[model samples]
Structure formats: structure tokens, C-alpha cells
Target: MARPTMEDVAARAGVSRALVSLVMRGSPKVSAARRAAVLTAAAELGYSPHAMARSLASRTSHVLGVMVSDLHNPFWAEVVDGLDGHARAAGFELVINTGGRSPARERRALRSLTSFRPAGIALLGPVVPSPAITAAADIPLVLISRSSRLSTVDTVNDDGRAGSALAVDHLVALGHRHIVHIDGGTGSQAAPRRTGYRLAMARYGLAPRVVHGEYTEAAGAAAIRALRRPFTAVIAANDLNAVGVLSALAEAGLRVPADVSVVGYDNTWLAALRHIGLTTIDQPRAEMGRLAASALISRVRGERTKPVRHLLRPTLVTRATTGPPPAPDPMP
Candidate 1:
């Protein structure tokens, strides 16, 4: 069967082609009753407007292109929810794609979003190179859960330093001096978190041992296995990594919060599960998304040219995974 078009919709609604076009463009000139008729007819015929054609005709678009870093992480989902809600409320729609955390794929994804000539773009936890991101400067851009020194870019990030510090403080308070930090290697915003951990350890007059790892469960597990000596507590780069450490510890016959304690960053739902009970840092994922959307939309509307950087504070969520360090050895 031939695809439905504006002409078909107009014919079905008994309205002129001009009226159908007006309705499709969402022109306020059309009466509610006539708009309803056209919409109903279009729906019945499964007619859909050609977004590209419409955008070209108007020289603008109501679409916001989004590039996500990792599709597997649940934290990004919460962020996307906030972004979607705010975008829709402001008469915009989202077009989403992902890079799966690869720089090459992210560059391609950025080009793809730019090709649509979207009103703006939002990058979620992107690991793409700075030059690649700067190349897409034709439209407004927002970086979510990432940081950039470029004045042209806007960013929304949780205070990674504070988050790491919180974990260290909690562990130290529980008499854990032999704590280890598994760092997110080459990951966005990893430096601040690593710095925070080091500073906190120094403040407590304790030696800090950092394991080089990526932001992944496998990395966390591997880092643990590579450790030379047993530590009383472990601070994972993120919740996903933390879970992996938990698994490794269990396999090693070490019980959490008894034989050892583990803390993670990002209070994702996985960290809150009753069985897992992971202590973590809350980063307000949804709020970060909302802010990113707001910043991008503002620039798209030509409301501001100045850069806006949102650095939100992080708080600790104490759970069963953290407790006093294991008892020392009995008399030799």
C-alpha cells in the first residue's frame, strides 16, 4: 500500500491541503476543531510528518539530539528521563543515539546528530575527544555528567571530589585505615574523584593506595584480585564497579562489612537493592539531566551565549556494605 501523505489526510478530513499543512506544522492559526479533524484523519491513515522536510522548510527544528555514552548503565536512564520530561514540556522532542563509550563511535554519533540540524544537542557521560565535540558548534550543546573548560560548552556534573571524600570519611570513621580506592582510568571526571580520595586519606594521616581501572565491573573485579595486601575497605569508582568488587570479594571468601567494607559512587537502583545494600554517593542523576536540558534549551532559544556550568553537591548514602574494619589477629 502507498504511504499516507498530507493530501490523503486532507482528503479524509474533508479539508484543503493548505489546512492539512497548517495542522502538521502546528500553526496556532488553525482552530481546535479543524486541528482535531486533521489529526484524527492522519492517525487513522497512519500518516506521519516528514521531520527532515519540515525542519528544512522552516529553517529550524524542535528536536534535541542526544548522544549517550553507555547504554548499559542505569544511571543514564534516570538522567534521560529528566531530560526528556523538560524537553517535552518546552515543546521539544528528543532523538537519542549512543556511542557505547567509544570515542570513534561517539564522533560518528555526533556527526549524525548534527546532520539532522537539531535545535540543540546534549551529550550524556560522553568520552569523545574535546575537538570532536567542539566541531559540532553549529548549534547549542550541553554536556551532562562531564566537564569541559571550553566557554562554548555547558556542563552538569556532580562534585566527584566531594563524593570520594564522603566515602573516605565514612570508612575512616568506621576505623578503616587500610582503605583502597579503585580509580576510573581515562574516564571523564575521574581525576577529581581520585584527587578527592587522595586528599581525604592525607587529612586522616593514612596512606592511599589507588588501583588503576576503568569504569566497569570487570575492571573493579580485576583491580581487587590484583591487590597485594588485604584492605579493610574499598572505594569503587562507581556503583557498577562496586558491584564487581563485591562479587570478587565474595569469591575470595570475604564477607562485606564484616571482613571488609565497600563504598561506591553513584546511588543507582542497583546500589539500593535490599540484597546488595551498597553504600554510595548520591549524585542527583535526574536533576543533572534537567539542568543540562535547561541550559541547552536556553542557548537554542538565543537566551544566553555565556557558558553555564552546573556542579551539584553529592551526599553519602550509608548502607550495610560499610561498617567497622575487621577485627585484628589474635595474640601471636
Candidate 2:
């Protein structure tokens, strides 16, 4: 069957095409009664306005492009929820794509979003190079879980360094001295988190052991397999990596919190599962999304010029994963 159009809605509502057009555009000139009639008629016919056509007509886009770094991670989903809610409330829609954590794919995803001529774009945990991001400056841009010095772009991020420090301090207070860190290699904000762990370890006069890892369960598992030194606790780059570490430790016949304790970053829903109960850092994923949307929309509306850098605080949520280090092994 042919798709319903504005003319069909106008005819069904017993109104002129121009009136239907006015109603569709949300023109204040239309009476409430006529608006109701048009809406009802359009609903009956399953008629909806073409957003692209409307955008072209007004030379203004009501769509916001969002590039997600990883689709498998639940963290990004929470952020998108916050972003979508705020964008919808502000009369805009979201077009989301993922780069699968690949920098090359991210560059392609960025280009795809730009082709739509959206009002603005939001990049969540993008790994794309600086130049690629800067090239997109023609459109209002917001970065989440990433940083930018461009005076034209905005950023929303949790204090990664502080988050890592919190985890380290919590474990140290529990009498854990030989704690190892599985760092998020090349991931957004990974540097600060790694630095924080090193700095905190130095502050406590303890040696810091870092294992190179990506923000993945596999990476966490691999890091554990690669460990050569004795340690009582581990700080993973993120919750996903922590879970992997848990699995690997179990396979190695080690009981969590009994033989070794673990901590993770990004307290995503996965971390809160009853079976998981990860001790992790809370990054306020939803709030980050909302702030990113607000920043981009504000820029789209020409409300601000100076870059808005939203650096939110992170907190530690203790769960089942962490405990005092096991008593020193009896001398052989």
C-alpha cells in the first residue's frame, strides 16, 4: 500500500493542504481545535512528517548524531538513555552509530553522521585521533568520556584520576599492599586512571604493578594470565575487564576476597548484578549523557560560544569483590 502523506491527512481532516502543512510544522497560527483535528486525522492514517524534508525546508536540522564507541558495553546504553530523553524533550531526535572501539571505524562513523547534516554531534568514548575530531568542528560537537582543548567543542567526563585513586585507597585501607592494576590501554581517559593508580601507590609507599589491557573482559583475563608477580589485589580498567579477571581467577582456583580482592571502574548495571556485585567506581553515566546533550543543543541554538567542559566527580561503591588481603603466607 502507498504510504500516507500530508495531503491524505488534510483530506481526511476536511482541511486545506496548507492548513495541514501549518499544523505539521507546529505553527502557532493554527487554532487548537484545528491542530487536534489534524493530529487525529494524521494518526488515523498513520501519517508522519518527513524530518529530512522539514529540515531542508527550514534549513535547520532537528536531529542529533551520536557516535558510540562500543555497542556491547552497557555503560554506553545508560548514557544514551539520558541523551535520548533530553534530546526528545528539546524537540530533537538521535541518530546513533557505533565504531566497535576501532579508531578507523570511528572516523568512518563520524563521517557518516556528518553526511546527515545534523544540528550537532556527540561522541561517546571515541578513540578517533584529535585531527579527525577537530575536522568535525563545522557542526556543534560534544565529547563524553573524552577530552578536547578546542575552544569550539564541549566535553563531559568523570574525573578518571580521582576514581582510580578512590579504588586504590579503599583497597589499601583494607590492608592490601601488593595491588596490581590492569590498565585500559588506548581507551578514552585511560591515561588519567593509570596515572592515578601509580600516584596513589607511590603515596602509600607501595610498588605499583601495571598490566597492559584493553577495556574488555578478554583483556582482563589476558592480563591475569600474563601476571608474573605475586599480588593480593587487582584494579581493573573497567567493570567488563574486572568480570574477565574474575573468570580467569576462578579458573586459576583462586577464591575472590579470600585469596585476592578486585576493584573495577564504571559501575555499570553489569557491576550491580547479584552474581557479580563488583566493587567499582560510579561514573554517573546517565548524567554524563544528559550534560553532553545539553551542551550540544545549547551550541546548536547559538546560546554559548565558550567551550563547556563538564568534569563530574566519581565515587566508590563497595560490593562483594573487595576485602582485606589474605594473611601473609606462612614461611616455608
Candidate 3:
């Protein structure tokens, strides 16, 4: 069957082509009853306006492009949910894609999003190079869980350093002197968290042992298996990594909180499970998402020129994971 067009919609709604066009463009000039008639007719015919063509005609778009670092991580999903809610409320829709945590793939994803000529773009925990990000300055850009020095870009990030310090402080308060931090290798915002951990350890006058790892369960498990020093507690890069540490410790016949306490960042739903209760830092994922969308929309509307950096505070959610260090054996 031939695809329906504005002419067909106009004929079905008993209105002129111009009226149908106005309704499709969301012009307020059209009467409420007439707009309803045209929309109903279009829906009946399963016809919708081509977004790109409409954008080209008006030089504006109702779409906002979003690039996420990893789809497998649930942390991004909460952020996207917040973004989608705010964007939809502002008469905008989101086009989301992921890079799977690969820089090359992220570059390709960025290019694909830019091809749509969206009104604005939001990058969530992106690992793409700074130059690649700067190249997209032609469009309004907001970043979540990433930082930028360019005045054209706006950033929304939780205080990773403060979050890490909170974790270290919690462990220290529980009498854990020997602590290990499994760092997120090359991950966005990793450096701040690592620095926070080191600084906190120094403040406590305790030696900090950092194990290089990626933001993954596999990396967490590997780091634990390769440990050469003794420690009473482990701080994972994120919730996923913390779960991996749990698994590795279980496999090695070590009980949590009894043998070695564990701490994690990013209080995702996975960390709240009854069976796998995890102590972690809360990043306000959804709030960050809303802020990112709001920032991008503000720029798209030409409401602001100065760049904004929103660094939200993080809090600790103590669950069943952390406890005081185990008592030493008294041998004869």
C-alpha cells in the first residue's frame, strides 16, 4: 500500500492541506477541535511526519541525542530514565545509543548521534577523547559523569573524590586499618575516586594499596585473585566490581564482614538486593540525568551562555557488606 501523506490526512479530516501541515508542525494557530481531527486522521492512517524533513524545514529539532558509555551497567539506565522524563516534559524526545566502554566505538556513536542534527546532545559517562567531544561543540552539549574545561560544554558529576573519601572513612571508623582500593582503569571519573581514596588513606596514616582494574566484575575478581598483600577490607570501583569481589571472596572460602569487609561505589539497584546487600556511595543517578537534560535544553533555547558545572554531593549507603577487621590470632 502507498504511504499516507498530508494530503491524505487533510482529505480524511475534511480540512485543507495547509491546515494539516500546521497541525503537523504543532502550530498553536490551529483550532483545538481541528487539531484533534487532523491528529486522529493521521493516526488512523498510521502516518507520522518525518522528523528529519521537519527539522530541515524549520531549522530546529525536537530531538535530543544521548550517548551512553555502557549499556550493560544499570547505573546508566537510572540516569537515562530521569533524562527521558525531563526531556519529554519539555516537548523533546531522546535518541539513545551506547559505546560499550570503547573509545573507538564511542567516537562512532558520537558521529552517529551528530548526524541527526539534534537540538542538543548529552553524553553519559563517555570515554571518547576530548578532541572528539570538542568537535561536536557545534551542537549544545551536556555531559554526565564526565568533566570538561571547554566553556561551550556543561558537565554534571557527582563528587567522586568525596564519595571515595566517605567510603574510606566508613571503613576506617569500623576499625579497618588495612584497606585495598580496586581502581577503575581509564574509566570516566576514575582519577578523582582514586585520588580520594589515596588522600583518605594518608589522613588516617594507613598504607593504601591500589589494585589496577577496569570498571568491571572481571577486573574486580582478577584484582582480588592477584593480591600480594594482606588487607581487611576492599573498596571496589563501582557496584558491579564490588559484586565481583564478593564472588571471588566466596569462591576462596572467605566470608564477607566476617573475614573481609567490602565497600563499593554507585549505589545501584544491584547493591540493594536482599541477598547481596552492598555498602556503597550514592551518586543520585536520576538527579544527574535531569540536570544534564535541563542544561542541554537551556542551551538549546539560548537561555544561557556561561558554562555550568554541577557537582552534586554523594552519600554513603551502609548495608551488610562492611564491618570491623577480624581479630588476630593469639598463638602460643
Deviation in Å, model 3, residue 203 alpha carbon: 0.3
Q: What is candidate 3's TM-score against the reference? A: 0.96
Candidate 1 lDDT by residue in tens digits, 83-134: 9999999988899999988999999999999999899999998899989988
Candidate 3 C-alpha lDDT tens digits along 1-332: 99898899999999999999899888999999999999999999999987776787778899999999988788999999999999999988888999999999999999999999999999999999999999999889999989999999999999999999999999999999999999999999999999999999999999989999988999899999988657899999999999999999998888999989999898999999999999999999889989999999999999999999999999999999999899988887
What's model 3's overall lDDT? 0.93
Q: Work out candidate 2's RMSD over C-alphas.
A: 1.3
TM-score comparison, 1 vs 2, better candidate: 2
For each candidate, what is the lDDT? 0.91, 0.94, 0.93
RMSD of each: 1.5, 1.3, 1.5
lDDT of 2 by residue, 149-253 (tens): 999999999999899999999999999999999998999999999999999999999999999999999999999988865899999999999999999999999
